[model samples]
Target: MGALAVVAALAVAECSGGSTGASPSAPAPSPSTASATCPSSLAPANPPAPAGAAAGAAPQVKLVVPVDTSTSTVLKPDPAQQLQCGKVQVDTKSDVAFAAPKLANGQAKQLLMDIQVPQTPGPKPLVVYVPGGGFVQDDKQGNLPLRTYAADAGFVVASIQYRVQPDGATYADSIADVKSAIRYLRAHASDYQIDPGKVGVWGDSAGGYLVAMVGVTNGDKQYDLGENLDQSSDVQAVVDKFGASDLSKLESDYDAASQQAAAGLMTVVGKYVNGPASTQPASATPATVAAANPITHIKPTDPPFVIFHGSADTLISPSQTLMLQNALKAAGVQSTRYVVEGAGHGDLSFTGDTKSALQWTSANVAAPLLDFLNQSLKG
Candidate 1:
């Protein structure tokens, strides 16, 4: 099947039942019965907040998503991708629309977010998901496959799409959109029956990088401009799947193939790496990618994190997770990791083409992911 056909097929399977279709090589993350254990990140007195954040206030942010439903659903899950084994009452819902941060056009694109609120309420935890496509591709109109998975496992789940770094747009704008979405979620948690304080952020690939940015810079005054008087939209937990954690380190791994792909991708994402090479060395080095990585920002005060990756991923090395795990351990923070044997980037599939890959990841990564999210989100 063609790309479009594959998507349609996946959609059908998501809406219907199991996807034991074509035996494509690149399978989705496999589903497994065994779950993972999420280390608790709760505090006795009060969950740690940013500097001087008001007590008992939930972190909030503006909804900064852009939706294109032409080929995608109305922010619902693709039938083909639904879990076949686990039939937990997801209690999923839709029509949770909001406006993203304004673009250079003096207006932001309309965002259609898929929200899954728990049946049992009383300020439930929240987990926002960002889909990855190098910041320019992918749609958010359909049910975010990962969000539904997270929701089924527990937390109030959300999947968002940020404005792309078009040929003329800047990367900074994409970053701004993330902050906007956080603010939006924080301000409107009650509407979705979520615990404003227990918000956690997670994403895959480029989405993973976006979540990292959100984690490292949560307290930045520029991005923390929310109306929440009680708390900031600071997340209590994070999960990154093979995202670019450090730019310089990423650049080091930039081979001819990657540079070629990046050259083509840069224009689409609007990354104009212009100007002459600086004469002086940057304050940060590629090796410190780990130190300068989101793991650097990790502390006992920061939210717990769990990262998963394929052991043999070429796009983003598995070693990245090792670095993150080590950092969290050294800092006395809570964390865990799982690596699939032969996955690449963040392809979380287990049927059709990548059925094997999917199966492996499910057995190794996604299942663990559910447990990790459960521990953090279910208080």
Candidate 2:
């Protein structure tokens, strides 16, 4: 805010203001963003950041187009910005400035983020996190808890907020926002001083769907147009926790066991499911549903993945993870799948020892997530 840095929640505009949804859409495609709503001063160029920071918010001094814009920019920190997240101390390390490329017709929303670097850095690896909110809920502000954990673990994290379907915007637009954010990162890789090649992605629930979308649609190069850009939005690693993995598969079996786990499927029909939302277009046709799912795209070269789900999940089945894991393995991809025996859809707190961590989501998940990025993107 001081040097013009925009945060994920207060994803400020470039002119001067700031402020900021949705589920997975289609297999995977290049991003196409409309106009941004965040103020210019709030952008990395002339940030008019929020006055009082959220204790739970990530410490972001840099302006990352929030979600849809041009190449991403990293600002330099004043080393004096001290943020307190409950009992944790977060440093908005850098006020790296950036601007969101002007949009077309739609207003831009800020998917604010906070980045944390390692103690000794030639350049630390990056993890761009997408928070979950079943197409109609959750945001960067909601993911404060998990973000702090990632920073303390050492990777330079990017906690993002994708576009929401606030009545006017469609579901596909939300997923497109995810792909757009990645493209921005790829297009301006050097500016963030990140290993463009070694980037990793992570998310929960709806966020997981976004991560999976990128994993399967990694090779499409249509979104990038810059010269130094790799034309590849492929990530090094993926971490999906209790997400709606296979939408088509869910449609096939609306099982009683899966009823609670994958509840929203019912909301589109009758009762038995009551979430924050659900809808059948009063105007559009059935084609929209199939057009907005992420599982439709599954490829071999996408990226290695580490997915976790709660066995007790009711909003989305644990078996959903299996459907995806099998797909990746069938395509000759490597993946680590773990189920928290008795947990539910929103619980990812299962702990496992470091040695057997891959089987759990404890301290083990972070290091392996880091290792996966190193294996694929590290130079």
Candidate 3:
């Protein structure tokens, strides 16, 4: 028979229950059962014997049946097959060079970033993550769990590498590197399937401070240097995790013990800006120190911010974040601060390497961060 004629015959056989060994009086299968059996239901009831088979022998024939599904009706919708439970698979691209920044030694270095893109259908919002390392070290891959979590949640996360104090790099170089990364993402948004219009930045500790600077100095041109100048480094949302706002006032915010404990960190900060943090002769000048503070750049038109700090943090001082939050509010900006109780600086509760740890972060940090980003960017 022709293909169409065969299919029609199968359909007639199916409707009439003809010669398939199924009793005519047999009860029809339930909707779920029918749907489940639809795949195998098209198998021919009788098959031709193999070419060398004995006359009396029955042989198996695997038939490829074509079914017209356009007119098929789904008797019942499967609750298991719902969009709410759908998850986007995440793909990671590592060590992608975004910029070539000149180091203090005058040697140009390729600044790289590790990006995580979701395999979802549409262009996803972009989130540039800067890792914290006391401004002396840039641990770009330090918090993979958090970065992966953000990626799984549908954001294109680029964990970036910036110049550090050890590279003889100044604060401007680091800030410029960050802004350049943002601009690079925007410039290549189509290549990475990123929604250039919706971009956000998240950082921890010194990195947090950098993101805050990026947030506050939205349209300031000083930091917008090196390639992709056409693209804006403006971020719609900022997440600051235990980052310093005002380096000069950090010591004052801390208690005597904390000041003594974080003295070395203050020295690193001073080195970053090239003058003084809470110590003398570190590297930074008074003007440089003032300019590095995110609070110094805060305006009413800056992006919305969500600052996370641990009450038990002694390194950056939760009060520093509080100072930032208060400054943002005073400037008529939208800022939300969440204090993770009993959690220390860069705590596992915020970074999450294990399942339980991720759960804790999802509940305390990621959930709120996602909510804030969705509202600020997706809206």
lDDT of each: 0.50, 0.46, 0.65
| Candidate 3 segments exceeding 4 Å error | 1-86, 255-258, 275-285, 348-362
TM-score of each: 0.64, 0.59, 0.72
Q: In candidate 2, what are the lDDT values of residues 187-273, reduced to their tens digit?
A: 665644566666788888778877887777676554332233434566778888766654544423333433332233233321101
Candidate ordering by lDDT (highest first): 3, 1, 2
lDDT of 3 by residue, 1-379 (tens): 1111221222233223222111223333221201011112111122221121122211221122221122211122122221121155667776677777766556676676878887878899999999775565565656665666677677888988887765666678888999999999999999788999999999988899999999998999999999999999998999998898877665555445444544444555565667212346333466777788888899999999988775555455666787788889899998888775544555332222122122224333456777787888778
Summed backbone clashes in each candidate are 42, 50, 5
Tens digits of per-residue lDDT, candidate 1, 1-379, equal 2112222332232223222211123333232222222212111112111111222321221112221122211121122332322335555454344443454446444444556665553677888887665444434432244455566556777766565543223434445556666667788877777877777888777677778667766675555432343447577778877676544444334345344433333322223121112222222334433333566566666677777665445445555556666666677777666555444444423112334233322433455667777788775
Better of 1 and 2 by TM-score: 1
Q: What lDDT would candidate 2 get against the real structure?
A: 0.46
Clashes of 1: 42
Task: Kindly indicate the candidate among 2 and 3 with the higher lDDT.
Answer: 3
Which candidate gets the maximum TM-score versus the true structure?
Answer: 3
User: What is candidate 3's local distance difference test score?
Assistant: 0.65
Q: What's the CA error at residue 187 for candidate 1, in Å?
A: 2.6
